[model samples]
Target: MKEYPIMFTAEMVRAILDGRKTQTRRCGDRWAKVRPGDRMWVKETWCWCWKCARLNDPEWYHSHDEDDPSIQLDKCGVKYAADSNNAFETCDPMNPKTRKEEFKWQPSIFMPRWASRITLEVVGNRSERVHDISREDCIAEGCPSQDWYRVNGGPEKWFMVLWCNINGKKPGRSWADNPLVHAIEFKRVKP
Candidate 1:
């Protein structure tokens, strides 16, 4: 079975750990290879001073204890502790020679499946524009609709900014840009 290493922000990780998130959007090109039966291993970007840490200042980087693999594994395995397997580091990002420090800030592409604690079975998937995502799907993306869009505005409005940010596109990439996104629905599974 094909497997994917899916990255999640810490907030979304918490939501997923809480069993509230069920859907996610990925760039169409990136997700094109994901089949319905594939499995997704969730990787959480550490919560830390990303901006400062990116400058190579160790102080900022270590402030949150993000370097500890066990911590990340623990954070990722919050809900699925029984199924978590840290005995083997995934091969994708780690060869026996890969230093532990190098794994700390490697991009998601380098994250190996074995690093994940949460595994999801892809139940369904569809292609749609960022704006085409429904309010329900937005909630699945971890937005608390009532609080996030308290005004007359709704999830779609809020989703626009979020979509742009995640995609690293500037604003106005909204429905006007009509960026293609793959909406993937999944169920938590025993790893």
Candidate 2:
């Protein structure tokens, strides 16, 4: 089967890890070609330890030495953003006293397959209008608790808010616009 890389926000990664997420919806036909048994490597925000990179691959490290030296490298390899909040931070090298917190975590889009810790196998796929999302699908898409839904005016409302937040900026992709989307269902698999 074919393998693909999928990006997830830290919150979605947490939901997947907690077994609360099993499906994802993408605007347009982005995931329409995905089929059952195809594998997807989840790419979340991550950061590599500079010290470890330099020690392991001196040549590669030397070639890209833009990493700040002040950033602490407690781990030996890549650290996923979903694993913890304590990520490396950069301090002012010139002024050691200046402690502006700049996270070292790279964007999920830039993550490489080798650094991924979660894999998913597509179990089902379908296409439907964004507004056609059901309450069950919302839960599968990692909707929060009942209490959260109550606060946010139920599951569909919550999903709409989230959808708008992520896709509203794109033309004809807003929740109100109700664009067609690909609904991809998946189950966690071995990395």
Candidate 3:
């Protein structure tokens, strides 16, 4: 039952959502009891939002049996239609046929403003090295031939995925060889 002293600020909360701020402390008379204005160390691994924390809570999770229907609602205030009658049709954004003709030429890709650029480092052999570059730099460097994908709605995480065309060969002899495309799990840097 460790305790943490966390001072909640709007900007810090925003930074946490943006993946810029990694750690937070929770202050109270319980747990790691401390006086006011005192700081508590928090590990990035322990930092999670209410939703994620709840989902991962063992006691609450294993005991819960009911489904929350509100989870299906879209941001636009539309509910999924249960009937197949087509009587309550809502505009589907994915339907290309219904899209405006004028906007047909525009790509359907949705890029976010936060991670338009991401710097990736290559830490291996030069011959096998794919490339060390940022997301924005890669996009600009490759021009029209560049490929990208979007990771839609999920926990407040830094959504970024950059790909390089590695000819059918794998970069490293071992599974952990390629440092360029390594998957780094998001852990709130402790403070």
Candidate 2 similarity to native, TM-score: 0.80
In each prediction, how many residue pairs overlap at the backbone (N, C-alpha, C within less than 3 A)? 0, 0, 8
lDDT of 3: 0.27
lDDT of 3 by residue, 121-156 (tens): 211111222233334433322222212223432221
lDDT of 2 by residue, 55-127 (tens): 3455654555344443234334567878864343432324323222223668999976666789999999999
lDDT, model 2, position 131: 89
Clashing pairs in 3: 3-32, 4-26, 5-25, 5-26, 6-25, 6-26, 6-27, 44-188
Q: Evaluate residue 77 in candidate 3 and report its C-alpha lDDT on the 0 to 100 scale.
A: 24
| lDDT (Cα atoms) of all candidates against the true structure | 0.63, 0.77, 0.27
> Between the candidate structures 1 and 3, which one is better when assessed by TM-score?
1
TM-score, one value per model: 0.61, 0.80, 0.19
Worst 10 residues of 3 by lDDT: 106-115
TM-score of candidate 3 against the unseen true structure: 0.19
Question: What is candidate 1's CA lDDT for residue 12?
Answer: 66
Clash total of candidate 3: 8
Higher-TM-score candidate of 2 and 3 = 2
